[model samples]
Every structure is written in structure tokens, then in C-alpha cells.
Target: MRTRRTRAATAGIGAAALAAAASGAVLPATSAAEPARQQPPPGCETDCEKVFDLSLPYDVRFTGWRDDSAPGGRSVLAYYIGDELHDSRELPDRGVQDAECGWDGDAQRCAVTYYTGAHSTGALSALLTADRGIEETDSVRGGAPGATLRQLDGNGRPDVALRQSTYDPNYADAPRYWETYLEFEGKFVRTGCGAPEQQPSPAPTEPLYGSCAYY
Candidate 1:
């Protein structure tokens, strides 16, 4: 009777263990903890300036910095939406000349113009939406003075117009104009629709306004 009672107790313990396993109440002896995620380095900590701001039903801000910690000063542009960082771009030069943000149709467009030395300049533009975030970015070899939006293709959505200038050593006094038109089908694409007219004889140093010839 003692042996029978001992066997009954052992069987009851086994049943309890099986029930715990079926109910997912059993745990392993050890578990590996997940690693923490790493974040990108901060864009600016000191010598920061608030360069651009726009209220498109949301708080949008653009801040910049001229970081001198490196060999040469680094130009940094950080974009924020509703106090949260959304995007950033960096350039190694004299710093940004201009930064602007505006609404273009259903998307919000932001642009930055930075000096590239020798009186030459470059621009960076981005297209973003409130829900989808940044959709695309374009780099152009020009200043932001002539950047504009127009309905070039008649697609109901506005297209982007970027202007650039070319100078000839012989005609240093005059600069030739070039315009790039970008249309959005699914993404921003060069339409190659607007080509500048032939440079007039003895081009004027001042900007010559003309129409684009669509090919």
C-alpha cells in the first residue's frame, strides 16, 4: 500500500506538469534580452540658429549650424515637424545662404541654398507630405532665387522649375540661363520639356527673361 500510494503521488505530479505545459504556464530557465536600438548623431548642439519656419497646419522648423569642431566648418540643416526631427542634410562650405518651406499643391516643399565657393552656389530641395513623410529630394547646380512652381504639363498638379546659369570666359560679363522642369508622375522626374533659347548675341550681364520651348 505504501508503494501504491507513492506511485499515485508521482502520477498526480506528472499530470500537473502536462496541464501547465498545455496552458503555456511553463517558462524556460533563461531568456535573451533584446538589444537596444541606436540613434543617429545630433545635428547641432551649439552655435545653432533657427533659419526657417512654416505653419502648414503643423509646426515646421528648419535649424542650421556652422560646426567648427572639424577641420573646416560643417554646414548642417535639420528639419523638424511638430518638434520632431524629420530630415537633415549636411554640406562642407561657407554655410547655407537661404532656406525656405512652402506648400506646393498637396505636398510641402523645402529648399536650401548653400555657397560652394567662388561665387558659385548649389541647392537642395525636398518634397514631403504630412502623413507620408519626405517623398523625394533634388539637388540642383544653382541658387534658390529662381525656384518656382507652375502647372507646366497641365496635370492639375504644379511642377518644379529650377534655374541655373552658365558663364563663358569670353562673355564673362553675360551669363546664359538654363531651366530644369520636374514633373511628378509617381515620383519627381525630369520632363525635359523646357529648354532655354539660344543665347542672344552679346548676352546681357543682367538676367534675360524668356519663355521655354517645349520639345
Candidate 2:
């Protein structure tokens, strides 16, 4: 793999828009054999901190964590496929959130959402990839409450949903969400990131990023 510096996008642009103009890198199509669908290694709880050793065709490690100062604001989720180094991003003033990762079989499934934040001058790119890279405009506006690594579609494949501020050209201020499924034959599809039209958060009692029926 031809490597480049790890650069963040300018926090409010689409993947194609920013990647075409910015410095971050994207992996090219691979002819390598597809790894089998395998579950995440045991002992992984939500927002896990340990290195998830993939132990597969490609050596990879998935790490997830939220910064201590503001809790889940400055969240850091990263993948070190072999040997790489990078930095900590700012917390979104209101929107944006931490990164999430897991296993969708032999692939490492991970997600990252973007928004226009007081602290986010980086890029506005959404990335979802594991067996095959699924980054197709994963950006959003309302921040951390919108991105998640969980089952959205009723399937066994790992899915990620991210809400972008603008998805359809027909409307403005439209909160568009998309769910990307990583499945057999790398059969990937798009769906809404998910949420009701009301105020964010199911109730004051639940955690900000907690799993609510409304989402």
C-alpha cells in the first residue's frame, strides 16, 4: 500500500468533495482475497479501549475512546493497520462525536462522522470501511449524537449510520442519514443514518450517545 500522511478533512465537506481537494488518503481497490465474515474478538464491550487484533490477511488494530476533559466530545477512534501515527481532534462545539469500530466477520468495521463545529476546522468526511472501504459521504451536522457502530438494517453484517446536514439537493437544512452495510461479496448499500424529527436525545435520563428506541 502506498502510504501518505494522516490528515483530517476540513470538517464540513463530502468525501469526494474534500478528498479531491484535501490531503487525507484513500485506499485503492484491492485484488487480495476477501477475508471471511467473522465476529469481533471476544471481551469487546461498548467504546472499548483495548487493541482489537484482527489477525487476518491484513494486520490491523481498532481502538476507541473519548477524551477525559469533556468526556465524549473529543473522541478518538483509529485503526493502525500495521504501523502509523496521528493526532487528537477538537471537540465539536455542539455536534460531532467519537469514532466507533468492531468486526463484521474477518473485516474491521469502523465509522467517523463530521460536522461544522467551533473546534472542527478539519475535514467534513464520513468514512466506513472494513473488508471493503465504504466511505460514501458519512458527514453530518448535529455531532456525536448521530454517528454509531451498531446494527441498523435487520441483517448480520455490521452496519454504520451517519447523519449529514445536507444529502438531497432538493432541500436545505435537511438532516440526511445513511446506513452502510458490509456484507457478502462486499455487497454494500446505502440507507438513512437515522433519527426522529424532534429534539435529539430520547430523554434527559438516557446517556447522550445511549441506544434509544427513537434512533
Candidate 3:
């Protein structure tokens, strides 16, 4: 993950200029204009903080907050275009535990992870583009640790690989590890290509085709 630094500009005149003005000294006039200050969206006026920001290629920002006043402390993910709110989505969990954003080929992608309770976790993945705007591409409710991008098939584009776990009462001593692969065909769709139990390793070494059972 790359971290970009944002420089905040001071809005007022310099201390030396203020002192010179107070001393009744003539000062040279300047026509330079101050850079526009970025402001948070109206929805974030109360309690919100920007968790992620990307300035390259496009100006994208993610603002998140947990509404303590609301029941169960509802979580929100707000999308921004240079501080101006483009849209916002309500998260299924309480708050965002982690967030990641970067370019996936020509599209900009983001994944947000959150905990539902003490024992369970969930994730939300979003895709941003010029024509489609920002769209929620995928979501996992429980037992999702994280997501990664990979080339699982012959397609040149990258696919989304989600790591998940499930518990079976019959196999109480062992938890089953499962993976969900999503391919972008106009939009994101399940490929049904990953089965951790069937493979000798956690992930398949070769490209997967069709269904895991058949392949």
C-alpha cells in the first residue's frame, strides 16, 4: 500500500507581514491567490473522518464514521470527489476496521473490512470508473479475512479472490477454508473456480477453468 501525503496551506498572512503592517510600514502588493481549501461533505459535518484518499489518475476519497448515537452504531462509507460528496453507502457492520484502495488496470478499486462482532468479520468491495461512477462490486457477510487481486483464468484482467472460512457442526475440530473468485465480465460475477478442500494447496497453482468440481 502506498501512502500519499497531503500538504495543508496556511490561510493567513505571514507573521512578518503582520508585524510590518502593525509598525505602519509600506508593504508591496501581491496578486497571488490562495489555493482552495477542501471541505468535508455535508453528511460528515458531525462525526466523520477520511480514512482513504487517492489523488493520481483521479481524485478519490473515502470517509467513514460510526454513528454512536444510532442503534448498533451504524457504519457509513462516503465517496468523495475532491472533498465534494459524490455518494455514500451504509456498511453492514458497525465500523470500518481496515480499508485499501488502488488502481486495478484501468479501474480504481477499494475494499473495506469491518467486524460484525467479537468473533466474525465482513468485507465490502467497490469499483470506480468514469462511466460507471462508484459501484459496490462485491460483499462478504461473515468469516471473510480479506481479499486479493489475481489472474485466476485466461482473461488478462485481474480477478478478485476472497478468503473465507466456515464452520460445520459435524467437523467441530476443523474449520473449512473456502475461496470465492469473482471475474469482471462487464460486471463482477462468481467464477466458482476455487475450492480449498479439493486442492492440495490453499490456492490453485494453474489457471482454473469452469467449476472447481469439474476442473
lDDT of each: 0.44, 0.33, 0.48
Model 1 misplaced regions, further than 4 Å: 1-41, 64-73, 102-107, 129-136, 143-166, 170-174, 178-215
Q: Which pairs clash (backbone N, Cα, C closer than 3 Å) in model 1?
A: none
Backbone clashes counted, model 1: 0
TM-score, candidate 2, is: 0.32
Full candidate order by lDDT, most accurate first: 3, 1, 2
User: lDDT by residue for model 1 over 151-186, one digit each (tens)?
Assistant: 455433334445444433333443445454544443
**How displaced is residue 59 in candidate 1, in Å?**
2.7
Error of 1 at 45 (Å): 1.9
Q: Which window of 10 residues has the lowest lDDT sum in candidate 3?
A: 26-35
Q: Of the candidates numbered 2 and 3, which has the greater TM-score value?
A: 3
lDDT of 3 by residue, 1-215 (tens): 11122333223323443554456543221122222555544445566655444342334455555555545555666554554556566654356655655445455566565666544555567765544445776665544444444556544334444544444343333343445454453344555554435222454433444443421
For every model shown, the clashing-pair count is 0, 20, 0
Q: What is the lDDT of residue 162 in candidate 2?
A: 41
Q: For model 2, what is the error of residue 99's alpha carbon versus the real structure, in angstroms, after optimal superposition?
A: 3.0
Q: Using TM-score, give the best candidate's number.
A: 3
